[model samples]
Structure formats: structure tokens, C-alpha cells
Target chain A: MIKIAQLSCGTEYSSVQSEIEKAAFSVGGKMVYPDVGADDIDAAVKEFGFNPRSPQLKLMIARAVQLAKGVYDADAVFIATCFRCAEAALVRNELRRYIQEHTKLPVVTYSFTERMKSAQLLTRMEALVTIVSRKELLARERQTGLTAGLDSGSSTTKALVMKDNKIIGKAWMPSYDVVESATTVLNQALEQAGYKLKDLEAIGTTGYGRFTLGRHFDAKLVQEELTVNSKGAVWLADRQKGEATILDIGGMDNKAITVRDGVPDNFTMGGVCAGASGRFLEMTANRLKIDVTELGKLAEKGDWRNAKMNSYCSIFGIQDLVTSLGEGKAFEDVAAAACHSVAEQVYEQQLQEIDIRRPIIQVGGTSLISGLVKEVGSVLGEMPIVPPDSQYIGAVGGALLSSGFLM
Target chain B: MKKIFIDPPNSMILFDIVERLGHEPLSTMAALQERVDNLEIDMPPMNVTLDDVISGLKYAGIEVPSGIRGRLATWGPHIDEADAAIVMAEAPYSFGCVGCERSNEMVKYLLRRRGIPVLWVEYPGDKEAAMRMLEKTKEFLGGLE
Candidate 1:
């Protein structure tokens, strides 16, 4: 059997995995789905040495490392990309160059838009598999060892330890000081795994505070937070069967990532300088004297079809919300309107150009709020894939990077 | 004196008004003209570049060609220098070049993100709206002094 390892930017190709697998099987190629465990993410990062100032490019480097690992035993690799995504467009050449140089495996990249037909995709996959199967299978020679990945995000720090391609321990904490928070999580994971820091083969770091934490930990590699999130989303969703889009709504920023064949093809983000973000929701919830958790439930109960919040600016949105509430409008309706407003802003500002292919995988803390998910779903007209551990995806991807599951 | 960036930088009327008010009207065309004048090219080169193409996509969220970048580049220095902006929303649709819809949208978006005070007006269909817009533009620019 032709052993082909598949790697992608997780949520981008969530539902498309089955089609790829079918195409592989039809061509007498057995697909090797890498365990979503652990590998030396830091080592991978060091191998691809591009220090990008842009957060998106930085994350692409991190993801490139993981996807490169997926090429280890495969006859060929397929990278799903989105054409309109500025970050993906910027890093595409670099990623292809790294993979070709390091793995020497045949890599096939294609973009999937709503206009792309399944038959066309299957035909392309078949052709690639057929062409690559004639090549001799590469043997796997590396041994599994304990590795760790640390992700120090803007609001939290997460750590994961993997042994023999299996996740043994994971921990997270609210982040204040990057080093302290990272250390706390690392220690917690180490305790859970019953291993000393000295025993770990290598360490990788990612997230907003990656540079700081990498230095403090003397981390062997550093990855981008967005790439880690994409990797984690792919693993969590069990290799999405078709075109998948990852909508990660974080505390201050929102990201829309579309994956073609497990690689981020296109992506857009909001809230860099200003726009609606999770903090906006929190503030709005607080003003209504409701817990952030309750905003979703209230939205579900309210009939807010006509309630429109016109402003894309969070401050303006809040002002509108305040005025609406003061006008004796139903609190639930107003809450729903807030959710709708955010959804509209995301769609208009970020996703207006790209053709969003479903099933959309909703990740990040805000995704947990059912109201926001419902609002976003209504706007896209498709329910999103919300994993139980959505909030921990970034850290999980970081850990996975260390474990070799994601390279 | 305040520097005010005007959309449809080719609008001679808007440019004249800004000059009459004793403010510098920053226009994209002026920037291109300055570059052309400085270079003294035998033939006027296209104003666009790869940087503008990318910036149009990144900053303005519009897909445009290098040619459009040439025109957009003229507005950049003014955007940086301007104390305020006056946008005639329908100017591009009416009197200005309508070949690139994306470029038009991009210019508008860029102006909004400049974080400077901006006065947006419709292309006046009647004398009343035109007078109101003129008053608003003068008042807005006058305050910059």
C-alpha cells in the first residue's frame, strides 16, 4: 500500500478529509493520518528560519513546521490554500520552498472555493496519487521521545507534553506575566506526566508572547499562534472531510481561516486596530448586568430579526446597545442584536471577498458562547463545528507541534 | 494651515475650494505629478507599483492592479500629512474615473482608517445639498485652524 501522510491547517479542510481519503484509496494509496500527539515543534521552527514581524507570517512559519512533519512518510503531500487570504498568499512560496528542501516529498497544493466541484477535486487527487505512487516509499526511521510545546497567548498560557506520539499531559492558566504563566503550565504538565524538564527532548513555544517565553524557556523552536490554532483545529475535528473554514474569535481579535487540503489557503483577521472583538461582547454583556455566558442564552430566547446594530466599531456598537436598552427594547433582543452586529462586522470586514466553504469550525473562547455561534451561523447559513476544547486549541496545537503529530 | 486629503483627488473644484480656504489640498494626482516632475521622464510612467497593489489589498481590503497603485500612491503622503479629510462619496461615481470600483472602495476605506476627522458628503443632486455640503466642508476645515 502506498503510505501517504496528510497534513493541513486543521479547520480549513475539516469536512474534506473523507473525499481526499476516498481519492487516495481509489488510487491504491493508503493514507497515514498522523497522530495528533507531540513532536519537536522547536526543532521544526529552527529548520525553517524565517523570523517574520507580521503575526500572520510568523504563524505560517510555525504551521510550515508541522505540515512538513506530515510529509515524513507520505508518497505525496497535499496543501489546501485560499487565494484571497493575504497571509496565506504572502507565505505560500516560503512554505512550499521549506517543504521541498527539507522533506523532498512531492507536495501538491490547491485552492478550494465554493465554485470548485468535488469531481474536479477527486480528479486532481487521483492524478497526484497515481503519479507519486510510482516512487519508492520512504521509511520512517525516527524514534519517539518526550517533547513539550508551550503557547503563551495574550490572555492565557498553555503547555502540553507528549510521549511516543501521545499527549500525556496538558495545562493552562490565565496569563499575566508571560514567563510566570508559561512556567506554571509547564510545571503542571510535567507533574501530570511525571517527567522532569531535563527529560524532555525539546521544547517549542507559540502565541503572542512566544518570543518572550521562548527566551525564558530556552525553547528550541518558536511557532506562530495562528498556525498552532489551525493545526489544533484540524486534529480536533478529526480531519475535516471537505472545505473547512476556521473562525477563531479571540479576546481582542477575530480570525477567519479557510483550509483547502488541511492547509490555510486564505485567511483574514479583524480587530487589529479597531473593530468588534470578544472584549466588545464582554463589555456589552457587563453593561446589561449579565454574565458573558448568559449572552448566548438570552439571544436564543429573544426574537431579534429586525433588531440591527449598524456600527462596526465596538464603542459605537455599545453606545447603540445602551440607547436601545434605554428605549425599553427587550434585553434579550438587544443582546441578540449585539451578536448579529458582530457577525455582520466579521462577514463584511473580513469574509466579504472570500467564498466561505462549509462546515465552518468555530474556535476560541467566544465560540463557546452559544449566542455568538448562533448569530455567526445565521449569517453564514451553516452551523459551525464547535469542539468541546475550543478554547484550548492554540495550546493544544503548540503541544502537538512538539509531539511530531503535526511536525 | 491644515492639510486636508480629498477623495477623487482629480476634483479641480474641491482642490480650488481647499486652496481658496487657505489650506493645502493633498491629492494623489499631485503626488504622481511631483514624482513625474522630479524624474523628468520622457514619457509619463504609470504611477502604480507592487507596493501599492499589496497595500490596496492589505490596508484598504481591495484587489487592484499595479496601475491603480500609481494613482493611489499620490494620496498616501497626503493621508499621512492631512489634519483632516473631505470625501465626496459620489464624486468617483459621477465625475471621477469609474474603471476601478475596487480602487474607489479602497480609497474610502483608507480614509476612514486614517483616524483623522473626515467629512463625507454625497454628490449634491440639488443646490440645497451642495450648499449644505460646502458649509460642512468649510466648517470642518475651518476648525482645523
Candidate 2:
């Protein structure tokens, strides 16, 4: 019997462990670390010569596992699914320590934020795949030859229609509604391909709005944004491998995934803050009464040698822009400089610590801006950046994943 | 003027009490640090510890050699200016939140240990109730006078 347990520490651990124990018992499995308590905490702290009140308590999870008696008939997996906070992280380490002190189990732990992203992706994929398979089972009976991918992003919605590994037709539109945005664009893409929705063999949905699309359509959704982008990017770049980092900058939010040896090991996202995203740039462009397209092109031609944006907050960054203008800096220079500043922040917070010794791929809506690519490249060094058809990697990946061409 | 200094990471109750005390209120260091990203500098953070709260009441200002009480205490002179000191309790019914409750208890304990007139202020959930409490406290202080 294989039993997996995700337990908490502090007072919350008792109830959670009880629930796990009951479930394991029903399944005819033995519990690991069955007698873990405050005594365990005291003995370990005493042996380790450390204060129990210190953050070291979090390391006890591993130690407790070491203290557990002999190997039982069941194989146990322990995952520390603690809440997100520095304190919680400290506590998580304590739990791991206890496990180490007691028994030896396959212990795996991830930060709360990373676990959340992984779970969110899993939730989306479950819904998307169910819908896609259902649509396909019906499509084979209907004798209709249509398949589509819908990307309902925060700023734009697009559909890619494909048949047998070839892009047959595509449709672009501004998206709305939880369901209709994905459905309408999908229908439009199928029509452009000269087929009906029922004609498509399978449809996959991907984007910031993928879950909403799942709610509306009977198609598969894949949430491995990194996997989706990597597949799409690898297809575009013809599977060349080295260290690779991909920056997918969308209108509202953006993510940077570091791909090593052709697989995504870790990634970082700027979801909680919009200031470090493409939307801030577009809004800034709008405020200046200039088309974002022109702003992008203008950025390619200017030099913001003196622009200084010291604020970590986007609101403050905007104020810094106004201050730059007041200092008699050219508007284009400030705008270009603003773009550079955001890229720098992304680099400092996300990329700087991670050694990306591979070719980097820049994708998504902001990838359309030649200046952004150029600026991001200047900071990232000379890495191979594969630009895909229509900078809509999310939707394209959804389509490709649905087709099973780039899973 | 009667002065009341409130420590940061305080008991929630004392936050309202010092505000009600009708004296100039200065928050302790940790409260200011928590708001560092959004901190506006109308005044720099005041450095004080449990012992300074008691000494401040006696000397009308903190004198450096007096030293701070409790763990992680630091010595600073300016803390003595306040006539009364308050510790803000973050927990409404209880004394403080998990990581913070320790410091809050320390300040309150040290002040009481030194026989300083330190008081625990409970948070009034509503604005009107808080104002009424303040008016009542002022009247009581006047009666004492």
C-alpha cells in the first residue's frame, strides 16, 4: 500500500494527522510517525542542543520520520504543504527535521507559492482534457473535420485552428465573458478554417482565463504554462537544447520559466503585482495618447541613457516617469527607459539569482514589441530567442496540446 | 503634558487605549518596520524597549544608560520624554498574535514590574464606541486631577 500524507505543524497538525490516519486505516495502511508529540520535540532539541523556541522546530519533520520504528508493510510519502509565510516556511523545516530524526520516508517539499501554481495548472488540465475528449468522441460520429485552440488572455483573445500538425486557419478578437470569449473566438477560428465547432476532433484552452474557458466549453485545458510554452517554443525553434529561459509577458501578468536541459525545473511569476507587466506599459502609452504599437516601435529607436526608475511599486514607477518628463527628458526616452526598468526589475527579482546558461525564448503579447525583445536580450546576453507566429503562445500551446502534437 | 508611547507589534487593545489617553502617541519600532514599503516619514521610528517605558515615565525622557529591558533590547535616550507608555495588543480578546504577543507581553510586564502606570487598552470595534470611550477616559483623568 502506498500512502501519501501532507501534514501541518503547530496546533493544526493534530487534526490534519488524524484525518490522514483515518484514511490510511480504511485503506489497510500503517501510519508513519504515529506517536509524534511534544516529547519528540523536546528529545530532538535536547540531542541537537538547540532551543525549542527557535525556528529550528520546523526542521523536526524530517527528524521525527527518522525516529519512527522499522519499515512497515506500507510505503509512505510525506509532503510539507504548509501555508505561505516566512514563519510557515520555518515551521515546515521543523516538521521535516522531526521526520529526519525519526523515520526515513521520501520527503518532498515546495514553497507554498510554487505548489499553488502547480495545483492551479492541475485543476485547469483536469477540466480541459475532459471537455476535449468528450468533444472528440462526438466529432468522430459527426464526420466533421475541425479542431481548435482558444486562448482567452487578460487583454486579448485568439483562436488557432489546426488539422494534422498544420495551422489551417486562425482568428483574432478582443475577448469578453467567462464562457463566450473562449467559445466565440473558437467558433470564429473554426469558421475561418471552413468548419463548424462539432467538426473539430479536439479543442484545448490555455491562458490566464483558461479556467473560465473550461467552465464554458467542453474542451481540454492544459495549465503547464511552462510545458505549453516550451512545447510551442521547441516546435518553433526545432528542438535545440542548452540552458533556456522563456519570458512570457502578457498584458496583465507575466511569467519567467527557466528551462534547463529541455525541461522546466523552476519558474517565477509576477501575478500579484501588475506594475511589472506589459499592461503597465500599454496604460502608460495610452496616457501619453500614443498607440502602443507606435510606442513599441519608438522604443526600438531611442536611448534612455539617463532614465532612473528606482521604485519597486508600479504606481511609484509611473510617478517616476512623470518626474522624468518634468526633468526635461524626452518622452520616448522615458518610455523606452520605462520598459527597460521593468525588464530590470523582472531580472532582479526572477532571473538574476537563477543561472540561465541556455538560449532564452521570449514569448506572449509583449514579445511583439521588437524593442522589448531587444532590451530583454541586452540584459539576458546573446541567447537564441524563438519568435512564434502571432506572439499568442498560450493559445497556440493550448491548440498544440489539444492536438497532442506538443504534449 | 502626559505622554503615552505605544510599542509596535503590540497588544491590539492598547492601540486604542493610548489613542484615548489624550496624549501624544508614538508607535514602537516594529510597527513602523512592518509598513516599511509604504512608510511615509512624518516622523522617524522611535526606538524603545520594555525598560524605557518605565524609565520614560520617571525621567520625562529616556536616558541611554538606563538600557532596555527584556530580550533583543537596545539602549536609547529619547524614550523618556513620554509620561505614559502603551503596548498595542494585536489580538482583540487575547493579548497578542503569535510571533508578536511575546514582545507585547514583555513591555506590559516590565512596565508593571517597575510599578509604572501602564494600562491595557481594549480595541473598540466601532468608531462611535471608541470616541465614547475616549471621552469617558478624559473625564476620568480629569476626576483624578
- Each candidate's root-mean-square deviation in Å? 18.3, 14.8
For A1-407, candidate 2 gives per-residue lDDT tens digits of 34434443321211123333444444344344433444454554455454433222423442444345442222343333333334445455555444444553433333322113233333222222222233332122111224567777778787888776566777666667747766677777777778877777767776667666755666764443545565555545544355567777767766665554344434545555667788778866876678777777777776757766656677888888888878988777877786787677677655642446566777777777776777787777664375666465655666666665223
lDDT of 2: 0.52
Instruction: Estimate how well candidate 1 is docked, as a DockQ score.
Output: 0.02
Candidate 2 error regions (>4 Å) = A1-146, A222-226, A240-243, A260-263, A352-357, A405-407, B1-145
Instruction: Give all candidates' CA lDDT scores.
Output: 0.64, 0.52
**Tens-digit lDDT track of model 1 for B77-109:** 577778888878755223544233444566777
Taking the true A–B contacts (Cα pairs closer than 8 Å), what share appears in each candidate? 0.00, 0.00
Using Cα atoms, each model's DockQ against the true complex is 0.02, 0.02
| Residues A1-407, model 1: lDDT tens digits | 76665543311111234445666676566656444222343344466765433332344455556556653355655555343444444355556557665664555554433223344445335434534542221111121478788877665677888777566888887789888888888999999999999988877787778778878877765655555576667666755345688898877677776665445544555453244677788888899998888998998777566465778777788888888887888988888888887777788766753447787889887887888899898888887889867776776665555544333
Give the Å error, residue A75, model 1.
Answer: 21
Task: Name the best candidate (by TM-score).
Answer: 2
